[model samples]
Target: MLPRVVRFDLLFVRTDYSDDDAWRDALAAATAVHPSNDFERCGAALQPVESPELSGLTSAQLVGLPRADYLAELAVADAQTMRDQTVLFVDLNELNKQVGRTFRAIPSQVEPIVANFSIANMDFHEFADNADPDGVFRGFTR
Candidate 1:
């Protein structure tokens, strides 16, 4: 079967109980149960002004670019100070198969795993004909 690639926007914020080990453990547990293919990339957060410059580019232009391109550009532009944020990109075809649902339908299943870490916010963006332009599913916590 063809792989169904999906992009997940994970926001890991620091908490009193949060540490690198805790974050790793949560991600490791999730991957053990729902093994994913290679992580496309991971990087620090990107600033808002950099969004247009990055997202507006065509797929061809985006290809071969480093994952931290936007973050680097933000540093050069000096729009605002960077924050302590970590973002990850992983393809969830295996997880989707295990859950017997598309990425859009499995947010509930994945929420528990994310909750194990110190996640300030999380969102899953599924590109489909019927999905919203912003995102199909999103969850936020303060």
Candidate 2:
């Protein structure tokens, strides 16, 4: 499920298959890789962008803070989207690609919803936990 949820965050292949069978076949090929004999069937939920659950908080706090806490914070207007304005980037597809594996796109994975890039939230504290103390931008944790 995480793979399906994170795949878009990981790659931009093509999720717009007009055919369901085509989509499944493509999904299989996309996930097949070194150490991975095949793709596993699993269930995942799609939270609508406008849905009550995903409506409020900025993109940042959604991950930096816990779901309940952030949801509560989001209930109030003018709330901080995150603990801070810190910015960071994590390449979600690196692990697979390192082994010469490719990533997949999620067009039909969900409706084509556009996120507000104008908003973002972050907690440097959360990011620091797994950050490379050596102060390099190369990569982290392989």
Candidate 3:
């Protein structure tokens, strides 16, 4: 039997753009060609990661977890290592804004990395069935 995987949308971006229409457009355009799933089926109800603080991680160690490409690679690798089917739903809108000018350039930088990984492509709804709807693996520092 396939492993019972947990899933949750990782809003790489903050909540500032949740109400921004232009941001949504850009996000849709970028995600459209992404080798993932149909963004249209991705629902808005998928719980947002509320805090920018990475869970399950201590602040001191987070600074050293990895940087840029390395950090992204770690996340993907960790997900794959799980014994269950796990999906990390990443939201690029807030992510783009966080890096300011670099935001728009992000999809290009991270997409290739994510594509090469064995991550699964799923919508918010599908992910919920796998992961805790209210509990995103925020990585604790402890």
Candidate 4:
């Protein structure tokens, strides 16, 4: 049998928690099992933008903005910058182990956070080439 390639779609819900801090803490805990590179491969980032946009906007234009305004702008910009979906590829046998690892690595308090998120899986198989000319007709008749 061929090794199956499984794809897991991890969907994040922004409103799962009541507050930003709780959500951030939950996310941190959930992602603690994997490194930034892993998340990157899955088309996600653990952190927000590293630098704020400073080239176009003047200091004068940014100076008077409220803290909430800045945060909101950053959120919008970050959302626009990052990929909208995250997908992870794994071997079929490793899928269950990976889930177990993630669950075990996260703190008990944040276990519910991981539970709230959903993972959907898909399996892909590679096409095989037949060596014999009669292989295609093995199960067919004229």
How many residue pairs clash in each candidate at the backbone level?
Answer: 0, 3, 16, 0
**Best lDDT among the predictions, by candidate number:** 3
lDDT of 2 by residue, 36-98 (tens): 123232322222122234334442333343332112111111111122111222222222232
Tens digit of per-residue lDDT, candidate 3, span 39-101: 222222111222334434322333343333322212221112122212233322223232111
- What TM-score do all the candidates reach, one by one? 0.19, 0.19, 0.26, 0.21
Error of 3 at 1 (Å): 31
Off by over 4 Å in 4: 1-8, 34-142
Over 8-83, each residue of candidate 4 has an lDDT whose tens digit, in order, gives 2222223222244554555554345443321222222223222233223322343333332111111111121122
Error of 3 at 119 (Å): 5.2
Candidate 2 stretches greater than 4 Å from native: 1-14, 34-142
Q: Candidate 2, overall lDDT?
A: 0.25
Ranking by TM-score: 3, 4, 1, 2
**lDDT for model 3:** 0.28
| Residue 26 error, candidate 1, Å | 2.6
Cα-based lDDT for every prediction: 0.26, 0.25, 0.28, 0.24
Best by TM-score: 3
* CA RMSD of each candidate after superposition: 14.9, 15.8, 16.7, 20.4
State in Å the error of residue 90, model 3: 12
Candidate 1 local lDDT, 1-142, one digit each (tens): 1111123323221121224454444333323333224333223221212233443232223322345311101111111101111122222223333211222212222433243211423322232223333323222221
**lDDT value, residue 138 of candidate 1:** 26
